[model samples]
Target: MLPKSILEHTLVLDIETVSAAASYAELSPTMQKLWALKAEALQRRLAEEEKMTAADYYPEKAGIYAEFGKIVCITVGVFTKNEEGQYKLRLKSFYGDDEKVLLQDFSAMLSKYFQRRGQQYVCGHNIKEFDMPYICRRMIVQGLPLPAPLQIYGKKPWELHHFLDSMTLWKFGDYKAYTSLKLLCGLFGIPTPKDDIDGSQVGRSYWEDGDLDRIEVYCKKDVFATAQVLLRFMLEDPLALIFESADG
Candidate 1:
């Protein structure tokens, strides 16, 4: 179980990403060739399955890879103590059509708030594997400096105290099995964040519908759900807590 002190200082976050371009045809010639190679490699792994062209798979699967995609929205939640001494999560989102601008905004927010505090942690489901690395890579791709907490290059595994992952906690040192946030939410009786859209549809939503709002809402819900999952891990009653938008 997480200590109350650690829980209070944690910031839960989720990010939504999409392909750098709306379609394969929109990619630069160099990127198109790279993607073709990537797709070919992926297809080779699925040789037993029905074959589909690389272009057909690019829109749906490319965003999960940071090298081939860009972040569209990053929704963050913080657990704040109430007057009653209970904690509630407050959420904020940084999002835009311009990846560099959004990343700059997010990096600035981290430097201003989270980085100055020594023990503050950034928490999310599967963050150690996906979200954290993706953020770091995209920041580099955009030529932004890595925030202090994110600069985990030479730190030994035992020294990473400022990064919390609900999935890692659930593993309890058993690293073989994987768990999805939605699946854990279901198991713990928390609301799943996929009612409207799942990660698989994010690329389509951004490229086809131009709906950053929808993606932001979905990302925010995941942030909330991740916080609730962490609360559950701490043996707290997740249902008793409520999250409010920081804007409101």
Candidate 2:
């Protein structure tokens, strides 16, 4: 089992996103033109799929870009002491159609919690490259003030002790290896977050099925799995059930 110390006050986060519009046809004429150019620039990565066109790429790849996508859910988990003085995780999700409202609420919670607890760790799987930067970009797009922990502009590398990435930690300085959260969970024997749906299905769920609730649940599961993966990194039992207590 994991030591209580490692989990305490550490934040785990995950986000679910979808294209800002339901379909390529729904995008503004200007945005469609922009995406066409962007797709052409990225076409080299699809060397084996030369048949795929820009319209074909939008549904699959656009959500990974904050400029083209919208975050439908952002789930954050933290270990807190229960009434019995035992450490257990608590998960909260901010989600809705109005991205600005959810972002504001999430930042407010971050500010209030960190103000009370002092500076601390903010962690997730592949968080350094994807989650944090995407959030910052979206916040700027919305003209929202960044939370203190996210004001990373021009800070020295060592100054970001509060930031952590489970994937980066596992790489052991192997910069080329890109490990997915699901792969780490399986390697560590933690429950898979893909039981319900995968990231590829998230956009379809939101735009076609209108299943935001399912997306929120999937996001929480990933956050929980991330915590489990981190515990394994601390040389603890990856199956630790402490996170089972996390209330969403």
* The best candidate in terms of lDDT: 1
The lDDT for every candidate, in the order shown, is 0.88, 0.83
In terms of lDDT, the poorest run of 10 residues in model 1 is 45-54
**How well does model 1 score by local distance difference test?**
0.88
Model 2 has a clash total of 0
Model 1, 3-73: lDDT tens digits are: 87787778898999898887888888998899999988888867566656778878977898999999999
- For candidate 2, the lDDT comes to 0.83
TM-score of 2: 0.91
State residue 81's C-alpha deviation in candidate 2, in Å: 4.5
TM-score of each: 0.96, 0.91
Root-mean-square deviation of candidate 1: 1.4
